[model samples]
Target: MADKSSSNAYWAANVRIILISLVIWFTCSFGFGILLRPMLSGISVGGTDLGFWFAQQGSILVFLVLIFFYAWKMGKIDAEHGVDE
Candidate 1:
C-alpha cells in the first residue's frame, strides 16, 4: 500500500536522524570531555579544566541543542512524509 510505504520511509528517516545525532552527542561528550582532556588542559574555562567544562556543561549544552535540532528537523520530515497530524 502507498500509505504503508510512506510510513516506512518516515520511520527510516527518523532512525537515520537519531543515529546521526547520537554520534554527534558522543563525540562532543566522551571524546572531547574525557579522552581528549589532556590535550586541552591548558585552555582553562572559568578557572577550571577545559575537559571538565566539556564533560559537564559543554555536553549538556550540546545535548539540548541536539534535542531541539532533532525535534525541529523531525517535525519538518514528518510534514514532508505526511506523517504530521
Candidate 2:
C-alpha cells in the first residue's frame, strides 16, 4: 500500500513537471513568437525584434534549458521517491 502511494506520487510529480515545461515551451515559441509578437516588437535582441528572436532562437534555447532542468529536477524527484540508482 505504501509503495503504491509513493509510486503514484512520483508519477504525479513527473506529470506536473512535464506539463509546466510544455507550457513554458509553448508560451515562448508560440505565444511570444506569434500571438504577442506585436507587443514585443518594440523590444530588441541580437539586432532583431524580441518576437523574431524568440521565434528563431530564444525558444530553442529555452527548450534546451528545459531539457536540462527536467533531467535535474527528475533526478531530485527520483531521489526523494527512493527510485534513484
Candidate 3:
C-alpha cells in the first residue's frame, strides 16, 4: 500500500524528469537550430548566425551537459529512495 505508492511516486518523478529533459533537447536541437533559425539570425557567433552554431555544435554541447545533469540528479533521487547502486 504505502510502499507501492512510494514506488509509483518515484517512477512518476523519474518520468517527469526524462520528459522535461527530452523537451529541452528537442527545443535546442530542432526548435532553435531549424524552426527558430531565422528569428535568431541577428545573433551572430564567429561571423555566423547563432542558429548555425547550435545546429553544428551548441546543441551537442547542451546534450552532453544534460546527460551529466540527469545522471547527477537521478543519483540523488535514488539515494533519497534508498535505491542507489
Candidate 4:
C-alpha cells in the first residue's frame, strides 16, 4: 500500500511537470507568436518586430530549452524516487 501511494505521488508529480511544460510551450508558440504578436510589435529586432522573431525562431529556441530542462528535471525526480533509468 505504501509503495503504491509513493508510486502514485511520483506519477502525479511527473504529470504536473508535463502539464506546466505544455502550457509554456503553447503560450510561447501560439500566444506570443500569433495572438499577442501585435502587442509585441513595438519591440524591434533588426528592424523587424519582436513578434516575428518569436514566431519564427524564439519559440523554437524556447522549446529546445524546455526539452532540456524537462529532461534534467525529470532525471532528478526519477532519482529521488529511485526509479531512474
Candidate 5:
C-alpha cells in the first residue's frame, strides 16, 4: 500500500545517505591519505605535504564535518517522511 511504499522510500533515502557519507569518509581517510599521497605530495598544507595533513588531521576534520552534515540532512529527511521529533 501507500504507507509501505513511503516506508520503503524513507529507508532507501536513509541508506543512500549513509552510503554517500561512508564513501566520503573512506576516500578522505584511505584514498587521500594513502593511495593518492604520492600524487598530492606537491601540495603543501601547514608546512607538511597535503597527503600527510590528510592522514594526520584533514580526515578527522572531514569526519566531524560529515557528522554535522549527516545530522542536518537526516533531520530534513525525517521531516519529509513525517518521522521527525
Candidate 6:
C-alpha cells in the first residue's frame, strides 16, 4: 500500500514537472521565436533577427538549460519522494 501510494505520488509529480517544462519550452520556442517574430524584429544578431536566433540557436540553448534544470529538479523531487535511483 505504501509503495503504491508512493508510486502514484511520483507519477503525479513527474507529470506536473513535464507539463510545466513543456509549456516553458513551447513558449520560448514558438512564442518568442516565431509567433512574436515581428515584435523582436528590432533586435538583430549577426545579420539575423533575434527571433531567428531563438528559433535556431536560442531554442537549443534554452533546451540545454531546461535539461539541466529538469535534472536538478528531478533529483530533488526524487529525493523528496524517496524515489531516487
Best by lDDT: 2
Return the clash pairs for model 3, or none: none
User: Whose TM-score is higher: candidate 1's or candidate 3's?
Assistant: 3
TM-score, model 1 to reference: 0.84
Error of 5 at 60 (Å): 0.3
Off by more than 4 A, model 2: none
- Looking at model 2, which ten-residue stretch has the lowest summed lDDT? 1-10
Per-residue CA lDDT of model 2 for 1-85, tens digit only, reads 2399999999999999999999999999999989999999989887879999998888899999999999999999999999998
User: Could you give me the TM-score of model 5 versus the true structure?
Assistant: 0.92
**Least well predicted 10-residue stretch by lDDT in candidate 3:** 1-10
Report how far residue 19 has shifted in candidate 1, in Å: 1.0
Give, for candidate 4, the lowest lDDT window spanning 10 residues.
1-10
| lDDT tens digits, residue span 1-85, model 3 | 2388778888887998899999999999998999999999999899999999999999999999999989999998888777787
Deviation (Å) of 63 in candidate 1? 0.7
Q: What's the candidate order when arranged by decreasing TM-score?
A: 3, 4, 5, 2, 1, 6
For model 4, what is the error of residue 35's alpha carbon versus the real structure, in angstroms, after optimal superposition? 0.7
Query: lDDT by residue for model 6 over 7-53, one digit each (tens)?
Result: 89888988899899999899889988999988999998999899999
Model 3 scores what on Cα lDDT? 0.91
TM-score versus the correct structure, for each prediction: 0.84, 0.91, 0.94, 0.93, 0.92, 0.81
TM-score of 6: 0.81
Question: Model 5 clash pairs?
Answer: none
**Candidate 6: global Cα-lDDT?**
0.89
Q: lDDT (0-100) at residue 29 of candidate 4? A: 92
